[model samples]
Target: MRTNIIRDEHVTVSYDVVNGWTVVEVDGDVDLRTSPMIREAVIRLLGEGHRHFVLDLCFVPFMDSMGLGMVVAITKRIREHGGSLRITYTPGPIVRVFEISGLHATYQIYHSPEEATQRTPSPDGLADWPHSPSVKKGS
Candidate 1:
């Protein structure tokens, strides 16, 4: 497995390939200030010929519209290249944004990184990811 790390004052991006999937783990707020780090990592991974991605946002407590937009853009690029993107470990506020923006159903979302990799995709090509066990049935 190959590993790469990028750190900024606001965010840190680290990734490695496991079982043919590139797992990018972010530790920080993914707002306008930090989206670039994530974007660069995704672009670098694409350049490296990775077709599957798992974005682990477990430690990201906040993500503004810019961050969400970057995620959407990356997803589009990956799909254009016949790749797949799975998002895991979203914080509550971030998850709410995704739900309110009607994006929860668009991306494959999972409670954990392990779940993200193991779940099978639904007919629509999105994984049937369940809510995090730590989160209650309804907020």
Candidate 2:
């Protein structure tokens, strides 16, 4: 089930579990104005005992440095608490933001929720689920 914590014109933040991982879907622009909502949503999920995450940013049309900062900060928080974060974004401005900021290499980013869900998280926070057989090692 999907639970929405907040929604407005600028952004909509909601989350649900997929393959035992919390999938937080952001369906709007993520900027200085909207980043906090996303962050707080993740924080709430974390409080609910979620340790694995997939940040689905496919719907985000735009993002700024502040948004990137928020993502990094959120990642740190999750890792600090012994959790894992996977990010997903379409090939567009959102990808551009990560590439320009040189964060694409830092994140376990994917193009779709299906892709993210099918993969394993970082070594420390490995999920109990098995990754897709199609996934080649060290790809």
Q: Highest TM-score: which candidate?
A: 2
Candidate 2 lDDT, tens digit per residue, 55-105?
Answer: 899999999988998897888778766887778888888978887887776
- What is candidate 1's CA lDDT for residue 33? 86
Compute the lDDT for candidate 2: 0.78
Model 1 per-residue lDDT at 53? 88
Candidate 1 lDDT score relative to the true structure: 0.73
Cα RMSD for predicted model 2: 5.0
lDDT at residue 1 of model 1 (Cα atoms): 53
CA-lDDT, candidates in order: 0.73, 0.78
lDDT at 139 for candidate 1? 13
Give model 2's TM-score versus the native structure.
0.86
lDDT tens digits, residue span 9-89, model 1: 888888877665678999999988889778888988888887788888888899889988999888777766677677887
